[model samples]
Target: MEFVRLLLLFLHLLGMGMLVAMFFVQRRAGADAPLNKGWLHAAALQLLTGVALVGLAPLTDQEYDHAKIGVKLLVLVVIAGLVAMNVSKPKPATWLTPTLAALVVVNTGIAVFWT
Candidate 1:
């Protein structure tokens, strides 16, 4: 159970990194390029690993603040929503990438400092 928890945490962190990287990737693709699908993929990964971690907490004898988890989940949902809404478009709005990046940073800060 400990190993499983750690593994999920590792993947969750990786997903966060992927999102951060997508910011750079999107920028490099130029303003006219469509939003990258990687944003959705990374967000999905984060969502899944996050849920699994919380759902398995009892079995792992871990205690978590439900309120904090709820906030993080909400933030992730917003990120995913934004990406889904714009991914199929020819080009994302000028505010999209930076907004997403800021959300990601905000989520990280919540996870680190909310305790």
Candidate 2:
């Protein structure tokens, strides 16, 4: 189970990196591509794996668990909203990519250090 959890964590981070890279590439190119499809897919995969990790991990009475879960969910929702906004506007916002990437990093930190 620990090995599986570690693997899932690795996959989750890889997916997040892909998504962040896609956003940066889009920013540089000034145009979107079918690659955005891959970004969305990766983001979804990360979210799934992250949730699975939380579910499979042993229970703890620490308040940090609930806080971490809440923050992760909030960040996920923000990222999804950013994606939706970009889709609707036909262009990614100036701050969207950086903001989402920062959120991901912060969430990762919380998972690694707060727990």
Candidate 3:
């Protein structure tokens, strides 16, 4: 169980790192490029690992603040929604990358500090 938890945590952190990396990657793609599909993939990874961690808490003899988890989930949902909506466009909005990056940072802050 501990190993499972650690694995999930590792994947979650990787998802966060992917999001951070995507920010820079998107920037370097130029103003006319489509939003990368990597954004959706990373958001999905974060979402799945996050929910699995929460779902396995009892089995792992762990506990979490429900309100904090809820808030983080909400933020992640927003990030995923933004990505899903824009992933197919010819060119993303100028504000989209920054907004997504800010949301990602906000979500990470919540996870780290909301204990």
Which residue runs does candidate 3 get wrong by more than 4 Å? none
Q: Count residue pairs with overlapping backbones in model 1.
A: 0
Candidate 2 Cα misplacement greater than 4 A, ranges:
31-35, 59-64
User: TM-score for each prediction?
Assistant: 0.98, 0.73, 0.98
Residue range 20-39, candidate 2, lDDT tens digits: 78767766766443225555
* Candidate with the larger TM-score of 1 and 2: 1
Candidate rank order under TM-score? 1, 3, 2
> What would the per-residue lDDT of candidate 3 be over residues 1-115, giving only the tens digit for each residue?
9999999999999999999999999999988889999999999999999999999999889899999999999999999999999999999999999999999999989988887
Model 2 residue 102 CA deviation in Å: 2.8
lDDT of 1 by residue, 9-114 (tens): 9999999999999999999999899999999999999999999999999998999999999999999999999999999999889999999999999999999999
Better of 1 and 2 by lDDT: 1
| Model 3: pairs clashing at backbone N, Cα or C within 3 Å | none
Model 2 per-residue lDDT at 45: 81
Candidate 1 Cα deviation (angstroms), residue 37:
0.3
lDDT rank, highest first?
A: 1, 3, 2
